[model samples]
Target: MRGKAAVVTGAAFGIGRATARLFAAEGAQLVLTDVDRDGLEVLREELAKTGAEIRTVVGDVSVAEDAREMIAAAVEDFGRIDTLVANAGIIPLQTVLETTPEDWDKVMAVDGRGMFLTCKYAIEEMLRSDGGGSIVCLSSISGLAGQSGQAAYGPAKFVATGLTKHLAVEWAARGIRINAVAPGTIRTERVRQLADEPGGPEYLEAIEKLHPMARLGEPEEVAAAILFLASDDASFITGAVLPVDGGYLAQ
Candidate 1:
């Protein structure tokens, strides 16, 4: 990733944060974004200390203008967008009967529409530039398989999964690679919060056992997979939904 320019959405937390740090360490100039301004600033400062060229856009990825600006930042600040990690999302663990119309729309806005707008703009920019880029979308194990409590999130991720394949095929001849990583339950900040809820520990324990590995994955672990898909290491790979699950999908 040396000298490459990358954009990471949802960059203030979890897998996004880890990816930004890793990308910086690997010598990529970054445009990190998230709705969390304070968190984005803190990450920017941390990466700056390492001399990583960092710019930040604090906005919602679901908004078209904000999505465009993220891609614009890459081109404006670093000449071109070499990669994009479309990792911005919201998880709503609810049953179909329990999920309201509003709840479903909210999840779709970020996880589905957000993914679409980011990739749309990024691909447009890539087409305009001399070089084409790679895109890594954040799918989930719920996206790959049916799950009990992900009524809203599961379908949204299916958008991530489907979009990856469609775009990969659509743009492959044009030199832009698109793929997705469908992760099992990862121990991200959101999941940690769930662990503190009433009956949360028991709920998590039961969930953990469902994975063949009998454990939850770390954010860094998922980030590593994202890095591979975003980098030239995955040159021959496109339209593939790689699982970062702890053997959950295998089962």
Candidate 2:
């Protein structure tokens, strides 16, 4: 990945941060973005010590203007974007009956529409480069199967999967590849917060047992999969939803 340029959104923490660090180690010039400005700064400093070329953008993915600027920054700094990881998202736990219209719209805007906009602009910039690029969207297991309380999040992610396939077909002849990664229960701060709540630990333990692996996944584990899809190794792969779910989706 030396001399390659990549952009990772929601890169302040969790899978996004893990992917940014891994990409940097592989010699890719990176542009990391997130709405969490403080976290982004801390992450920038931590990774900068590695002597990797890095840039940071503090903005929300739900806004089209911000998405455009992020892509523009990558091009302005690195001359072209080689890969894009549209990983910014929110997972609000709410049942169908409990979810409000506003919540549904918010989740869709960030998880579904945000991905569309990112791919839209990234493709535009990538077409201008010497060669085309790859794009990976962060989807979830809920997008594949029904979950107890993922009314809004699940449907929105399902749309992300669909978007990935659509773009892959529409742009394949143009040399751009698009795909998605559906992650299972990963051990992140968000998951930890749920587990710390009343009965949340027991609930999580039961869920863990349901997976054949009998363990929750790590953010870096998923990051590894995303990295592969973003690299030349996956040149032949497109419009595919690769599951990193510890066999949860298999069952």
Candidate 3:
């Protein structure tokens, strides 16, 4: 990934942050964006200490203008975009009856709409480069199967899977590869927060038991999968949803 330019959204924490660090370690120049400006700045400083070329953008992925500006920043600063990790998402787990219309819209806006906007702009910049690039969208195990409390979250991820396939097929001729990483039970700060909520810990424990590995995944584990798909190691791979779960989907 040396000399390549990449963009990672929702990069202030969790999976997004891990992916950004992984890419930087491989010598890819990075453009990181997140709504959490303070955290983003902190991460920017940390990565800067490693002597990696990185630029931080404080913006909401749900906004179209923010997505546009993020891509522009990548091009202006790095000359071209070689990869994109559309990892921005929000999970508001609610049953059908428990979910309000606004809740559904909010999840859809960030997870579904935000992904669409990111891919749209990323592809535009990628096409300008001599060699097209790879794109990895963050889906979830919920996307491959149903979960009781994911009324809104599930559908958003399902849409992301569809988007991945569509982009991979439509852009294959242009050397653009689009794929998705569906993670399950990753141990992240978000998961910790969810576990602290009512009945959240029990729910998480049950999920862990269902996994054949009988353990929760790490954010770095998912980041490894994302990195594989984004790098030349996966040159022939496209339109596939690679699961980094501990056999959760299998069971």
Task: Give the number of the best model, judged by lDDT.
Answer: 1
The TM-score of predicted model 1 comes to: 0.99
The candidates, ranked best first by lDDT, are 1, 3, 2
lDDT, candidate 2, 1-251, per-residue tens: 78988999999989999999999999999999999999999999999999989999988888999999888888999999989999999988889999999999999999988898888999999888849899999988988898888999999989988998999999999899999999998987798898778878887998899788999999999999999999999999999999999999998
lDDT of 3 by residue, 1-251 (tens): 89989999999999999998899899999999999999899999999999999999989888999999998888999998889999999988789999999999999999999999999999998887758999999999988889888999999999999999999999999999999999997888888897779998898888889889999999999999999999999999999999999998886
How big is the positional error of residue 213 in model 2, measured in Å on the Cα after superposition? Answer: 0.5
Q: Whole-model Cα lDDT per candidate?
A: 0.94, 0.92, 0.93
Inter-residue clash pairs, candidate 1 = none
TM-score of model 3 (CA atoms): 0.98
TM-score of each predicted structure versus truth: 0.99, 0.98, 0.98
Please give, for residues 112-179, the per-residue lDDT of candidate 1 as tens digits: 99999999999999999958789999999999999998999999999999999999999999899999
Against the true structure, candidate 2 reaches a TM-score of 0.98
After superposing candidate 2, which stretches have Cα over 4 Å from the reference? none
lDDT score, candidate 1, position 144: 91
On lDDT, who's better, 1 or 3?
1
Residue-pair clashes per candidate, as listed?
Answer: 0, 0, 0
